[model samples]
Target chain A: MKRNSRLSLALHTLSHMADDPDRVRTSADIADHAGTNPVVVRRVLGRLREAGLLTSEKGHSGGWKLARKPERITLADVYLALDESLVATANEDSDPVCSVEYALHRRVSGVLREIEQSLVKRLGETTISEIR
Target chain B: MKRNSRLSLALHTLSHMADDPDRVRTSADIADHAGTNPVVVRRVLGRLREAGLLTSEKGHSGGWKLARKPERITLADVYLALDESLVATANEDSDPVCSVEYALHRRVSGVLREIEQSLVKRLGETTISEIR
Candidate 1:
């Protein structure tokens, strides 16, 4: 399966915003810096706004800006904003009759849950300011 | 991007093999149980064999079997056998001139590396025997 880079892209865009909080960054400009299309930039940043990490303005001089200081936003915050699981598991519901599959799924799921928790905790320890 | 489930699939397949070590399972049989195609099963199991976790034999009775006891095989071993990164990074080299991009890439890479190492360590703590 392909790996998602939304987190990376969001962080990249946020860091650019943090570089100059007063300067509004248009989707086209951010996309140019991010080596992606404006639609993708807008899509990712839109999630960031919904997460309360960013704000978008409309009309003349309209663009995206961080809602709070970089120090106030942690990597964990960004991660949660992206709304994706940190790990993947097999589709357990896909094969209900197989006891072997059930047992395997249970164990793997438990371990993955632990790993994701650990990752989120570690991420919470780091703020966007620390990275920027 | 879609999350890859190869690790979960490998663990599931290994647990099944561990349940009856004396029984040799064919690719088709494993595929049926794995809710995947035979080719997918063979491809994944082929990596497990190359990692010395299983053995494949040829002949009318030929199939696949664990090369060692389940207790000796850790989830980390299975993960390494699959040879996939636990985390994804943006294509950093895609934009070389942007310093903001560079800073974001460096920090993100460091965090992901730490997360991967932590994940591998946790996986190493559990073995196929425990899961089975």
Candidate 2:
């Protein structure tokens, strides 16, 4: 499967915030470090905020910061918030009704679910603090 | 990161071959099962043949079959042949040279490599024979 960039950006940004959990990182600053548009950075951070992974402020001096200790956050949390898939699966339209196709999809789906669980379990074991 | 569908199709095809291990499945058959274009199925199958995952034959009875025993094949091998990424990483254009961005990329790259290793290791442990 193709690698998606958004998830990477989110994790990288979270790691930075984890490094200095006490300080607020303006979206501009994060955008500068991420080398992406400030709007993009804000959009990702906004999701994190919505998920309670981080908190943000809108004022001049305000920005974003980890909502909780880095030790409490996991990569899985970030990934889930981003709604990324760990395993590749046939698209819905790839094959709709043949019994063989159905069987294959069922098997592949099972494998993906397993892999997703494994990935989440691994990510859950590592806190944002540990990455920093 | 969002999982791409192409890789899944490639792997699913290989798995089917590994199950039978000897039968030559036609492009039309595979496409019928995969619910995709015969051309798309052939294209993916072509790559597998190139990678020695399977061999294809032409003409009325010609189709595809695994190049090797399921026991000799690994999911990781199929995944690599499909050229799918296991971890999400920032896109090249996301940020081009900021120190923080670079550093983050480096770290994430390292992690991806590690995860890739772990994933392959696990996949390698299971052969197509075992899956079937």
Candidate 3:
């Protein structure tokens, strides 16, 4: 198993946006620079926009721009925007027939929650400006 | 996505073993304590056995026992024993049609590697005895 690539992509994009907060960069251009598909860039940007970290416009000369200052944003904000979970799992049945499975899940979930909170806390301490 | 329950199982089971050190535990018994399926515990044990963190026997009265002292083992050892990756991913094709996807994968992979290393470092600092 591997972590999602969206995490870094979101951070990288945010750094770019933060570098030039006043300029609006289209997804196409961002994708080109980032060496990815424009569609993928747009999808990521959409999530950031929804997170209120960025805003966008629809027109020939319109694209995406940061909604807030670079210092105000963190990696956690981007991760939340992408709706990425801190842990990974397969289809675990709602009713795990085995009690051991139940206990195992609970304990693991606790650790995962702790890890995630730690991750968020670390990310929270760093701003987009730092990455850029 | 959530992290693998096996990670916790490995750690928790190791902690228990460390506490007793002399008592051999059956999968069923361990599962009961941890609230999971015996099969799951056995499978996790199998991995631990392979990793040299544990060993098992297969007889009427046989079960599993730690291969090493609690002070000699860490959570990273358990995680490695379970072959669990620090990151999570869905089927990412070897050939990403999009360059951004490729770049994203590389960057994410880098960060994941760093995080995994960090986790291992932290886990290495603590032993099963500590957890117990």
Candidate 4:
């Protein structure tokens, strides 16, 4: 559940960010609150930045801040930004010779794919503003 | 995604079993086919047994077999049986002093819980018989 951990970390970090959307938060500051390493915080922040939900400024008095209003961003935005390795069922074999294995893999994968889409949809129902 | 791996293993294993639902296959046989250890196979089978998906027997000519017909079993049944520590969002703190953390956890947890329910529902749509 490492991926889940990251998702939680990002959500919590963003919740804090949502509290003060305009305030700049250094990786150290975020890490301190989350009790995690600054590097980890930076990585997650970087992902959000790339996704346009956050902005990071470099230099002596620079850090991270929300790029948009909290209400504009959804939990789905944070989750989709991270795109962590999926918890999915796939064919274990290199080339499944057995039709049974192949068919099972195909069917399970399709179900998981659909589930992921619905998950994203459900997550989008809640905005960052609503969470905080 | 180890949980997903186990899910895949159980599904593929069951698909094979569906091919010959009445066949008494030992853990060793399953382990060999899945390229995993017998102990691992036994552990997974044990969970399935508890879920009433499969049955186990002891003695010289004993192993594992489906408790019911493949047509009656669904992918959700296999997924539900394992209950592989959910991939969920949760409150990391013992007592979240920050209202932001508390609200985010409660909100995200609910969203993920709903998503899981949808996932199970989607999985239930496909029976083991349909996969193979």
Candidate 5:
């Protein structure tokens, strides 16, 4: 599994936006601050916008701004916007004939599901406002 | 971030081993059952052995077996052996000037640590014997 840094980057960007909600920040500005490329910043922020946590404008003076107050944006919202599964099974297609494998998959899947729920619940407990 | 299937694969392999403790399973055999390459199986299982959950013999008729009772092995053991951090920060090294990023990192890090502890605790609650 490859470690994902998008959530970290997004949270960093969002907190910066919350610090000065009245000031519209461009993707370039975010990218520079994040020490990454603008494309990466745009991609992450685009998801946040789609999730309605952010709003973007097209004009020169227009850029990105938070759609809702920082207090309302939870880390769980950011996690969902990133659209990555918290856990994944090794066998994409399991063999039904292998009962041992079947039982193992079922048990691990149950545990992973619980872990994901706990993670998301914890994320929901934290807001961007609180972090910033 | 790419989703990792190593833990799932390791659990599947371990449960299979537990199913028939008397059988010595080779990496090739495990790979065939896992629908993955032998090298991948060796890498994952090697980590398990290093963590004292498995034992391996090198010559002919030599293969892999559980180092401890199935009931003694926990998913947390496998997770720690994998040597991958449960959560990774977007910025490997944070910039001191960016207080917002600093604060976000600290807060998210705290939540992630708690999540990891919860996940490990849940994993410890289930032994390979229970799953098998």
Candidate 6:
């Protein structure tokens, strides 16, 4: 995602969470550290929770906690959990009327898919616990 | 770039250019085929020209022509020429006051850089000539 920092925020907050995996971090606290607002923190972290990478509670002391072991959570896991792509897929012309455009799209999409898979594989090599 | 289709546009145009490498295509024509405007085609092609991937002429009958052999123009050249990143770098908190934040930035930046470089390398492996 170009210039999008949600991944950065998610990773940074998760790195802190990895240090104390059991500790619950309020969205407000994460927002404070991330230099953002609680709503934004919740939005990003919410995606992680939905992906089963995290769990959140709603009480006043409610916050987010790791749903899995720090070592079990790879950067790829967080990246995938966010369910967004750093490399934008050229899905344009899903059905091109032109042959050249069609071929280019097909070939480029294949290459991009390969790169994406490789990227995920590389990311999977590093767990959140490895960050520290 | 997030959801940016400039790469797809450039590659598609160039792939067409490859078919008749010596033939010049007007910006208006490229735009029409790309389902965009001439200005957009000019802008994207301008970047490719700067990267020595393509060349343009002025006035009537003026248009874009491949500056190099299609084999010499790799997707990496086109991608880098855009000077935009598909993968968002975690350059936030460049000067983090917190150590965890600092380490996360450093480590994440490293991982992203690796992915970017690997992406470029993979892109370089495919030249415009090979696209067809």
Which candidate wins on DockQ?
1
Tens-digit lDDT track of model 3 for B1-132: 124667766776777677788798899998877667899888888988988988898999899998878889876687677766654344445566477546655554555455556655555665667642
Q: Rate the local accuracy (lDDT) of all candidates.
A: 0.78, 0.73, 0.70, 0.77, 0.76, 0.79
Select the stronger candidate by TM-score from 1 and 3: 1
Q: Which structure is stronger by TM-score: 1 or 5?
A: 1
As a whole number from 0 to 100, the lDDT of residue B44 in candidate 5 is 87
Sorted into a CAPRI-style docking class, model 1 comes out as acceptable
TM-score of each: 0.86, 0.87, 0.70, 0.81, 0.84, 0.88
| Model 5: lDDT of residue A27 | 88
TM-score of chain B of each: 0.87, 0.80, 0.84, 0.90, 0.88, 0.92
Q: For residues A1-132, write the lDDT of model 3, one tens digit per residue.
A: 123657656776777676679998999888876667899888878888888999999998999999988899976788778877644343455566467556655555555465556655555665777652
Candidate 3 segments exceeding 4 Å error: A1-3, A31-40, A87-109, B1-3, B31-40, B87-112, B129-132
Kindly indicate the candidate among 3 and 5 with the higher DockQ: 5
TM-score of chain B of 4: 0.90
- lDDT by residue (B46-92, candidate 6, tens digit) is 99988888889999899999998988888889889997676656456
lDDT of 1 by residue, B1-132 (tens): 014667777877888778888799888888877678888888888999999999998788889999998889998899889987656553456745567566666776776677677777777888887772
Clashing pairs in 2: A1-B84, A94-B35, A95-B35
- Candidates 4 and 5 compared: the better one by TM-score is 5
Which clashing pairs does model 1 show?
none
Q: After superposition, how far is residue B70 of candidate 4 from its true place, in Å?
A: 2.8
> Which segments of candidate 4 are over 4 A away from where they belong?
A1-3, A89-104, B1-3, B89-104
The C-alpha stretches of model 2 lying farther than 4 A from their native spots are A1-3, A88-96, B1-3, B88-101
Once superposed on the true structure, which residue ranges of model 5 sit more than 4 Å away at CA?
A: A1-3, A94-103, B1-3, B94-111
Give the Å shift of residue A28 in candidate 1. 1.9
lDDT of 1: 0.78
